[model samples]
Target: MRKPENESRTKTIKAMYTQIVNELRARILSGELTQGSRIATEYEIAQQYHVSRGTVRQALGELTREGLLERVQGSGTFVRSSVHTHEAETSLPAQKNIGVILSHATDELNMRLLRGIEQAARSRGYQVIFAYSEENDQLLARDIASLQMTTAGLILFPLSNRSIDSTIVRLKQVGFPVVLVDRYLADMDNDYVVSDNVGGGYRATEHLAILGHTRIGFAYSRAGDLRTTSVRDRWEGYRKALYEYQRPFDDSLILADLPTDAEPDTDLFDALIRRPDLPSAIFAVNDWVALEFIKAATRTGVRIPEDVAIVGFDDLSYDEHLSVPLTSIAQQGIAMGMHAATLLINRIEKHVLGEPKHIVLPTQLIVRQSCGARLQVLRAPDEKPS
Candidate 1:
């Protein structure tokens, strides 16, 4: 039966809008559009899909009603912050699934870790679900509770700001198969995997000391405290290296109050400038903070590796491309992720018995131009300028 032109066009438009809505919903389910992330404007979506603005608006409106998106006046639409209500209404498959809860998901380190986990899970025929905690303890607790309903087991990167001791204890009491990664709670009995932070810190400090740096300083972000597992371990390694080198420890050499926010704090640099005697070298807790210190030092006319050498933990990809290539401790994030997944899966399948497994991977030092080691090599008479 042939329909009128107006009726045919109306049906076609409705089909197009329905397709758009389904596509957007699929993205949300696939984790391509994360919670609280901004989505494209109606105009942008219409242009991309070659659809009318009305069609785009209709599609977005439907998603908003379904509790998948929220639109603000004068601002763009965003994914809803909470997915519990949506998940509650949806029917999930009965297939085996593993849940991963991380403090963050966007950074390079975390992405690599996710890759390793996904690779391992795929080989084992298990689906992987991800939840971002943003280092919030309350959010982490909620995510754990939600994932517990559907997933077979769980993997977690514990928050540094607040302890999840009570939550983990509860999970343990329920006999949930769980594995901890990156950070661990001291009093908890859980399978875990972590990098050798103390060894990395010691090696970084020792490298500077070996390079004839007597006055060495330690720099850490204010986001983490001395009680934090990773930070405390690194600091202990620094102290151990100092003792081994017979170097005197000076409290003034520690710069432990750098701002953790995205915006730079000039006052932190001011403290460094006002010091009567600047340290010959600085060991930053991580690569990002090391780069921040470099930027601050440059603003104050302090030349890196000349006036003050610098070393950092975490050999991030961009470290080599920096103005002064950073010397850092290499952490095997991907390996750690794979190991954590293996541990969790084994527990879930009952392949591992008896006590929980705690694995601490080794770290290595990656030397670059920032630590003055390259300068020494270049200055040698037998060495050619590569």
Candidate 2:
């Protein structure tokens, strides 16, 4: 029997093989590599990708099975004559697969949701494929078109939250089995699974209000047009909480589009710090934004919760490890994924019949040191670091 070390190695090799297959398939679809044109030999491909000959062979074999590649035994692997053009990809019958399109594949929340989708999909005897949209609308549309050729159904964590996208509308027109995850277009009635962002926002803000924070800032984005249903819902909840607590909503404290993950934008945050009557706490859009606020505050010697309490949505995995563990709203990501996949599979297999279903899961407020509930109060920080 193979040991755990061998199992790890096998998974890595399999991942490498799948990557190679995707890259090669993309080349064929884009006409970069033409049909009936010979590709590099196993040894050459192995060298180019820095993978082993066995891995190259495995990738070629899978493509061959998919009718995208042909092996002449002696001559090298060649693009199949039938596999031409992206539009013509559906020349072959669709596979028993479910495709998931999301913003990022490596994100913790996305990964967790994918685990649930994969669990539900495989248990129903369906294979799952994934494509990343990187939050681009054009690329997301292109991905949906390409994936539909091979997959039985698709689940989208779409790029836009503002308006009804034409691509998704077309899918509905054709009656294609597709489910929207995390966010949905409010105009259309479609199958969707999402967390209760409004409640999550309300809970986070109420927590801060309970801690005696009357001046709470909503850290939204300057890119007002891109705010999705999830973001808008959260903001609505923030407003609701303020009304409930009888706190005045200050428009001046609205921090918009200060990105720190890609490139640090210190001007907005720094300007907020200079305000004479600054907010005592901040409710960030998400954990990424919360972390960015904490980072900016830490840099300027503005303490967390003490100086200004910070709370975020989408309780990410590494929140606890921060210098000040962030208090965040935890969504049922796994359950969301499972529900989405199950719903899509039901449509695919004709197991369920009814109007389109929209499932909204609940959220939990995870309190930690960042909220000043468990740690020493803010004023005790006594001195600022120079």
Candidate 3:
């Protein structure tokens, strides 16, 4: 007997589903889908491919597991993050390639630094392979291990909280060419390049003091723990600068654990600023945190520079774009990255080089409208000869 039309239709649907899935997979792998683009939905796909909804769902499920598509709870499906593509490129070459290990690529500071590294690497005929960890100690260790096997040289941004001295020591013992960025292990002999964090912090505070502002606030995440060298250095600088100004350090003015994860906290900032004895000025550890202060202060009807001045580290892209642009300690991210990459490449080329070296770069204070020290808003303060 011949099969019924419904039975034939079922078999046809299965075949069409397979074809659709293969086509979509190919498009994603070839970079055709693109990051942040929405993939076709089950209903749309079912209509287009002449397949049942069940068949479409099955196809999407397979790709989602492979990290190709992401299914949001209520917002519909999207292409999964693009970090895996960087992982795929890690295996390409040794000499012509350099590996950049970062904590988070989505972070503004990290992206700026990576842009610098990419510029220097491309000009010098080198390709960059980037790997990012979510600041997890174990995942960071794995990333470091992967770099050792795949690339010619390594540039790492180490996890801040946990101890990784042993791992750094092990890499050094094996004669690996590594340049640490932003963070460094205590007393470790590994070659590293970092900003003059202490000096930057001191200058930010000293500048506030010179303007006749007392009771300044220092804001940061995990401020007292001193998990990383930068945090410790900044805190030390704050103390030193206050001491020089003959201002008594008040523990109550310091704000810690201000939600540096993903986004800044408004309520926390509000509480800090609402204090009866509010800080005349605040020094933030980075630009993101400074933006938070600006937003929170504005919401509370506080005027920038007039009520509370603000300064930030890492002069970021949007710093100058704000209504009241921010003052910041300008870290030479591109120059630092270029220098670190060149050092690593040099070591890779000179295989006989015996020991690693450390390099510290200088930082500059970029005065802007936010600090109340702008040339136009206030009278000029005499500059001390350098």
Candidate 4:
């Protein structure tokens, strides 16, 4: 029997739905909505495409299953954000591309770094792809493996507290243009760009010491196993300050290994302050952790600058607006990103010519209200070297 006219029309409608979905997917992947943004309603989408609401829902439903849209009850629908689309014409034959493998999308510091990298990559006409590991060693290994499978060059910010993995070592041995950032890998010599973490720690502690804080405690992410180079460097800095001030290097004063792997231990800070033997001041590993410490202290009725002082690392975007106004080590994250991208691009260009080069950038301390209570004599201190 011959197909009916209605059946043919239904087939055409289904094809049209596929077309609409593809068009919308293209737009989303091209960063039209980008991150954590909602799209128009199904009714609106139907009206825009001149299709039935059912058809629109079907298309969106499929996209949602594919992790392209997030549907919320009563709150409507949103675009899912976990892919990068490039405008590079495939006709050019193997265009240069860079891959960045980071831990996760957690804070503004990493976002600012991404902005710098994007600026540099777009300027040089290179496509950039990003991958995030869920802070798991196995997951990080998988990401690295995937990067090795595709991509020309890689920029990695490893996630580990103590040591480098053998998988990373194998990847480096395969002559991968892997430039590390933020964290360093032991037993492997590769191009990397990192901030002066140790110096930042030293300066923060030193600032606290100068304020007449004889008993200053250091708080960081990891506790006993300070294997990560950044952690060790910062802890060393803390010790250096204590030694210089002739204070006993009490291990109890160093709060390491936060409650979770992702962030610092805010609960510990609260408990520490509640204890009768409280340090005069505290130096936090990062700005986020510092903020948490400040909040905890405030909640416990600890007066800032009077009862307890605080200094943090990574002068984050919102540090100035923070309640206590963070005093932190200002790492040029954007500059670091730009510089790392430039280095990777140079490697890609020079692959046809020669070898790759490693780059290093310095870090600086930004004095603010949190640690300025003791610097009243100087009024405005000179900007210290990074």
Error of 1 at 179 (Å): 1.0
lDDT of 1 by residue, 230-275 (tens): 7778888898998999877888878886785678687777557446
In model 3, residue pairs whose N, Cα or C atoms come closer than 3 Å (at least 3 residues apart or on different chains), thus clashing, are none
Q: Model 3: per-residue lDDT, tens digit, 178-238? A: 8898767776767777888899999998988887777888888852246678777887888
Clashes of each: 0, 5, 0, 7
Candidate 3 clashes: the total is 0
Each candidate structure's TM-score, on Cα atoms with residue i matched to residue i, is: 0.75, 0.73, 0.72, 0.71
lDDT score for candidate 4 against the true structure: 0.71
For all candidates in order, the CA lDDT equals 0.79, 0.79, 0.75, 0.71
Model 4 misplacement above 4 A: 1-95, 223-225, 260-267, 351-358, 372-386
| Residue 77, model 3: Cα distance from true site in angstroms | 25
Top-TM-score candidate index: 1
User: What's model 3's lDDT at 296?
Assistant: 82
Regions of candidate 2 where Cα sits further than 4 Å from its true position: 1-95, 222-226, 375-386
